[model samples]
Target: MEEELISKKELLELKGISYGTLYRWKRKQLIPDEWFIKRSVPSGQETFFPRDLILERVDSILNSKEETSLDDLAKVLYGSPVEMNITLNELVERKMISDAARSAAEPFITGPTDYYGALTVFSIGREIDSGDISLDDAGTMIRSMAAAEDREMLRQGVTRLYRKQGVTFCAIISDASKVSMDVSSKLVLEISMPRAAAAFKAKLLPNKGEEEDE
Candidate 1:
């Protein structure tokens, strides 16, 4: 499905912000680079943004800027860093990782657990739940893949698992929606951020006043 897009001019007018501020935010990585879409119009090339996502994020930045530092805001917007440690109980309680995942992954984890490790466990749990791979096979795959020098790429900010022809690999990704295919003949599947997050049962931060009043 095509994303609902709005031109930069329209966005600036709607938000009452200047081009300078928008570009500044882009430079600071507050906005995803992929969201700044360039398209050809009859008149000329124009820059557009994903309407709903961009608007919601801009509103968050505006509402929280006074209280939250930009650096922290970036973390919240992207996701909490993997370096932030959380106990298995805390992970299950918050629903960040499932109980089954924790149990299945218990034997693999060493020392204190971090968000990255928890996410990896959760990912493998998904594969097991789908019957695409058994728990034991998933464990073996994890160990093999984790041994690579590029293993850090697996859990770096945002990670994506690419599976093709029964082979699976994980890598860090910037824009989740687009596939990086150098050749046109290569097949690709694109999943929107909202849908992917939903499939993963991930929780998104609530915008101000977005939650139902108690």
Candidate 2:
């Protein structure tokens, strides 16, 4: 079969890429290296199988949403598409994320998860501003609420709380996590968060012997 060939100038115009970027892709092995054939009797050099491959790579890059540089784009344009998919899946599995949470990380995400993991929710047991309710009054309120069987339901939560530089942090829990009950007085909300989240955000201590909850 006859291979179509294009000059470097023609290639750049067709691919809508600058010459330096194209050369950089070559240096990084992001694209298949071109062959240089030299004949002692004739011209300087020749590059074979050039244009079609470059075009194929450019098409792939244009279609992708990722903000890739020339070299990275060349890598994708030249490398197996499946490797990228597998790498992303591996990252998600390492984070201890389950299948359900993985699905919610949609089109914008390159990975299987959107960094959602379990969080440690602490109740300060008082309003942020003590002026709104005295500490003693807030304690009474909490005690009253905790005494009721439906403390969670009775409390009207922060719908439009005016605060300084704070917002809600959403997270997901592992399927393994559940309420552990014992003959004691506390309810243990066992959770499995990603290592990064558990370490930095969840405020949960490492694996330990937890007291059995009632």
Candidate 3:
């Protein structure tokens, strides 16, 4: 198949993205180096991009802005370690965590798991292993996440973990994270549900041809 190419000027105008932002994303490796295809044209040597890939990546970046940090979005878009998936057994077999950690993580899973869910479990295990949180506390965190109204809400949100002096606190707030939990405790685990359906939508899902259509 002939690879579709889009000019830098066209890309910026089409996506309403600024040149500075584009290069910055490039520097951060949010967009791959090879995607910046520099070639000589009638006007001059100009930068171009693999049409579909760049647009999809840009969409992912824009959609993730409020949902997560740019660094996290970069990881998700580039399939970084945090974005990789592992089964419950594999998580332990690979020594990413102990069997006890997996036991603590089981209560958080409401259904068949995905990469994001696995990452959450792995994170909980790491916190327990490092003594940042106790096994019971980890279970509390997992249960909190699992209590989200739906899988999508749990999958699409920010998890804030705060530590001050000897106290540790964690909260998961998604567009669709609404739920009830004990907040008076030092460990606060609750989901702030989305007020509207649009708020709960997942941005990372592929928006194929969205830019092209524009």
RMSD of each: 7.1, 23.5, 14.7
**Candidate with best TM-score:** 1
Sliding window of 10 residues with minimal summed lDDT for model 2: 203-212
Give the best candidate by lDDT: 3
The digit string of per-residue lDDT tens for model 2 on 1-214 reads: 4556666656677768897866666676555553222223246554443455456555554554254464544433333221212222443344423333233222223433211211111121113232443333333333332233432222212211112233212112223235232333332111222222212211211111121121
RMSD of 1: 7.1
Model 3 per-residue lDDT tens digits across residues 8-121: 999999989998998888777678676788999998899988886778778877876775666755654542433333467765765655787889987666454665566566
lDDT of each: 0.59, 0.34, 0.61
Clashing pairs in 2: 182-213
What digit string (tens of lDDT, one per residue) describes model 1 on residues 1-214?
Answer: 7879999989999999999989878877678687799999999999999897788778877877886677666665654342445566666776656666666666667556654455555566666666665555566545543343553444432444455565554444555556564332322222233333322322323422232242
Q: For model 3, how big is the CA root-mean-square deviation?
A: 14.7
Ranking by TM-score: 1, 3, 2
